[model samples]
Target: MIPNVLTIAGTDPTGGAGIQADLKAFSANGAYGMSVVTAVVAQNTRGVGSIVAMEPEFVAEQIAAVFEDVRVDAVKIGMVANADIADAIRQSLDTYAQCPVVLDPVMVAKSGDHLMQQDDVEAIRERLVPRATLITPNLPEASVLLDRDVEMSSLEEMHASLEELRALGSQWVLLKGGHLGGEESIDILTGHETVELTAPRVDTINDHGTGCTLSAAIAALLPRHGYIDAVRQAKKYLTAALRHADELDVGAGHGPVHHFHALWNNAPLQLQGAQR
Candidate 1:
């Protein structure tokens, strides 16, 4: 059966990140996609220009509506702008606690813009992180969660932080080391056991939606595969998407990964000028 994966996230009009990326990742990974919008963000490959948050009550209502109808096999949570929204999501998710939840802990955009409120970090760490089946946080995000002034810089530090992050309440923790400069990108997963996943880093400028896509991919695969296997497959998927990202021209800044890279045999057809 095709798993029904739900992504509770903000929007990216450019379709490179946020809810758009999540849906694409879900479909790419052979899962039926569903969404609950938490914010409407005006952003592109360049950066986040603005974000308009949804009311906490309405966010709760959307979750309720989905749970009433859909059999969500797994869920990917991203970009809750404030504490109220986090609380709302936590309360709603309390009812349907069976499915695997992958929380990306998206605090800052790839463009260096902050997507969340400074005060909201506490809520995510305290309320949402504990509830997630797995929490994927990069070095910067992990540092923020641990209230550290500096990011983890080495493999030793990453290993240390993985244990610390697992203590933050999630059953599993994936600490991404893509921020570190190296020939290979490494991630540490700790839960039933600790293992390091390493992939040859692809050199690319178009990596806009990597985090969202990865977490979504994991959620899509979790219903069928175990946690460690799902993460390995998701990592492979994201790496391929990144490898093929340069084939498309989407924006001036960081472009989106080619989510359908493995499936598309032909390049996109460009249209000539015509009457609108």
Candidate 2:
């Protein structure tokens, strides 16, 4: 059976990040995608301009509505704009705690714009981190979560942070080392065992939604794959997406990775009025 994976996140009209990217990654990973919007964000490949967060009550209602009818096999959470919404998600998700949850602690955008407030960080750590089956945090996010002034830059540093991150209550923590300067990107997964997932870094400017895509891919794969296997497969998918990212001509600034790179083999789009 196809896994029913749900994404609880903000909107990215550009289809590169947030809920749009989550849905695309879910489909590419062979899962049925569902979504509950938390914020309406005005963003593109360039950057986020503005955001309007949904009421906490409405956010809970949306989650309740999906759970009351559908079988949510897994969930990927991203960009909860504030503390209240995070609280609402934490509470709303309690009833269905059995489903696997992948939490991407999205604090900043690719453009270096802050997507969440400083205080909101605490709320996520307190409410969501403990509830997550796996928490995927890039280097900078890990620093913020640990309240470190500088980001962890070396493999030793990443390994050191793993125990501290796991102490926050997550069953597993995948610390992404993409920010490290190297030809290979290494992500350390710690929980049942320590595993290093290494992929040749795809050098490209179009990595706008890489974090969102990775976590969503993991969530979509978790129902069928084991913990370490899911992380490995998700890393493989994201690497291919990044490698093919340049094939797309989306926008001026940092663009998005190709979520459907494996399936969409450069077929020309059919124009409405063009001759065949």
Report lDDT (Cα) of residue 33, candidate 1. 95
lDDT of 2 by residue, 1-276 (tens): 999999999999989999999999999999999999999999998888999999999999999999999999999999999999999999999976469999999999999999989989999999999999999999999999999999887999999888999999999999999999799999999999999999998989999999999999999999999999999999999999999999899999999999998788766566588896
Query: Hey, what RMSD does candidate 2 come out at?
Result: 1.4
How well does candidate 2 score on lDDT at residue 166?
Answer: 98
Candidate 1 Cα outliers beyond 4 Å, as residue runs: 266-276
lDDT for 71 in candidate 1 is 91
User: Weakest 10 consecutive residues, lDDT, candidate 1?
Assistant: 265-274
**Candidate 1, 127-243: lDDT as tens digits:** 999999999999999999999999999999999777778888999999999999799999999999999999999999999989999999999999999999999999999999999
Model 1, residue 125: displacement in angstroms? 0.5
**Candidate 2, superposed: residue stretches over 4 Å from native:** 266-276
Q: List the global CA lDDT of all models.
A: 0.94, 0.94
